[model samples]
Target chain A: SQQGEEDPQALSIQEGENATMNCSYKTSINNLQWYRQNSGRGLVHLILIRSNEREKHSGRLRVTLDTSKKSSSLLITASRAADTASYFCAFFSGGYNKLIFGAGTRLAVHP
Target chain B: GAGVSQSPRYKVAKRGQDVALRCDPISGHVSLFWYQQALGQGPEFLTYFQNEAQLDKSGLPSDRFFAERPEGSVSTLKIQRTQQEDSAVYLCASSLAPGGFDSPLHFGNGTRLTVT
Candidate 1:
């Protein structure tokens, strides 16, 4: 499957704590993107890190990409209750113009 | 500006029936995509369109599924002989970029289709 695998199918953290999620893919990619999906809602784009970039940041979110490892990670700092959502990693390969998403990591941030 | 919009927020269809889902992309967005997401799973790419041209549909599961964007602004996904396995949420997303991976996508709330 072209789909990537996300580490820790689920995670729980306090409102003020930080949460991290990892994703590993099999093929080379043009860029990797992270999305957050609230229950019963469509996904919202969080951040994107190109294969050539080692890290990128957006507000409280941080993303890292390691092309050699074929892996990427997303970190949420000072997570809030609203941060509770399923986080998915999607990689766009040159071969496939569309993004392939992982199963996702379900996160629960307790207030 | 309005975001992507998908009609019939919810639908219930009996097995063997045909169903059509509609998506209205963000105005002037050059790229649109359709995805199928099962319960507790990530969205799976179904098809992609650049303007009115269907550039890639390699992710479509079978011939039972068909999608079109004739005028390049609105799109429709039609499922023929719907089966129980076809029960899933259909999501539509549009990007400002033409056909590359550089831009982020704006997604609709999605239409939840239940096949019984």
Candidate 2:
């Protein structure tokens, strides 16, 4: 099975509202990273949180990693219409160089 | 020079036909990866290459899938005898090093293959 699994497969929120997505993994990891995909285009790197780090912030995005529970959460505050996209969580295992991705969370930010 | 580049943005092939997809990674990148993504899902690992060496290909779904990175720069993913179940987006990504702890993978726009 893929290492990461994201919750709330689909979400819809009004503009300016906050959106939160959660991800759970099954194994110990070196780092967890978040990516955003618009339509069918390629994924864009968003934020990354290392196993040793509890939380990280990038602009309007806040990511938290709880290695004990093997879970992570991404919080987007004050989202805009541009934020409507599919967000995925991928993990890099300490044992290998390849990254495994979660199914992803589809977010729709209404204007 | 510019992020990862993949050709044939869209491809349509008849069942049992063979198709090839190309990828040109950023110059100087040593790590390359291939992934398959079905509709409404995240990309799944397909293969990995370190320079000209294919270190891992455990993710390939079947023997019909073949990938190579000759000269350690450009890559090609070829699918022989395609099946309807094989229709999906083929993604290519590249990174500067093997660990990828310091450099995250840069993905291309992807090649959407439709097997009719």
lDDT, candidate 1, at B68: 99
lDDT of 2 by residue, B10-109 (tens): 9999999999999999999999999999999999999999999998888999999999998999999999999999999999999898845556889999
Model 2 alpha-carbon miss at residue B71, Å: 0.3
For residues B1-116, what per-residue lDDT tens digits would candidate 1 score against the true structure? 48999988999999999999999999999999999999899999989999999999998999999999999999999999999999999999999888747889889999999999
Residue B91, model 2: Cα distance from true site in angstroms: 0.3
Residue by residue across A1-111, what tens digits does model 1's lDDT show?
A: 446999989999999999999999988888889999999999899988887899999999999999999999999999999999999999775454588899999999999
lDDT of 2 by residue, A1-93 (tens): 577889999999999999999999988888899999999799889988888999999999999999999999999999999999999999875
Which regions in candidate 2 have their CA more than 4 angstroms from the true location?
Answer: none
Interface RMS deviation of candidate 2:
1.4
The candidates' DockQ values read 0.69, 0.72
